[model samples]
Target: MSARLTQRQRALQKFIEILVNLKGQMCGLGIPLVAAFENIGKENTGGVWSDIFMQCSSIMKERNINAGEAWKKALENNKNIYLDECDYEQLWDFGERLGKSDRLNQEKVLELEKEKLTIMEKKAREVAETRGKLYRSLGALTGAAVVILLI
Candidate 1:
């Protein structure tokens, strides 16, 4: 479970990085949000990150909603089974603030979320490394003891 959680955190970190890049392309390169999402989606391709962005783009194009609402809607529609409540909370916060202000502010929000996810990923990795080994060792010992008793 810890390993799976670590993977999810890493995926989220990559997702945030993509969002940062998407923001840069929109702000610095003057690309439209829908086009930017389509471009980024093509570049990243395959994975929940791409799917979420593509969905957001689709929602924005079809419904004429703002980026934040589209983002929140995409996240809600595609539930990540691996992520826990805390992870969802952070993601929800990010979705709430996305595209609500200037480019700099949006970048700041992405950066902060990235930092928080980094810390969480590190902690989850540590737990997986330590506790995973312990669990395996305990299971082996228990098996050996049972065999000895049976013999």
Candidate 2:
């Protein structure tokens, strides 16, 4: 139980570090969104996401990770790719967003994404610092209680 508590909190810490590095590269090197995504995904995930586009295609039919897949499709086709577009929102599949008229510029989307992620990073930092300790304590206390009850 304590391990679970620690694992979850550690994942959040990793998220913060990864997001910062991602934003750093974007601001520092000015790489394209697709290249950035590919590079970050591969580098951060340790090759689990080496070909995120291909992985996104495999996950397309599933409901999860739709926005991510949409991002991949936009890049693969060299079209503007907003994180979310209403016209493409209800399309129900990754393929539908292709060649759409309503897509936003990738650079603009990247800027917005970074801004949003900056705010998210701040919030994540708070949670990682405070809530993690609270949760870990609770987990340990709960385990102790269980042991007491068993004894």
Query: Which candidate has the highest lDDT of all?
Result: 1
Off by more than 4 A, model 2: 1-54, 57-69, 72-105
The parts of candidate 1 lying over 4 Å away from their true place are 135-151
Cα lDDT tens digits for candidate 1, 78-146: 786467678777777777776667767766776787788778777666766887778778888999999
Name every residue pair that clashes in candidate 1: none
Worst 10 residues of 2 by lDDT: 78-87
lDDT of each: 0.74, 0.46
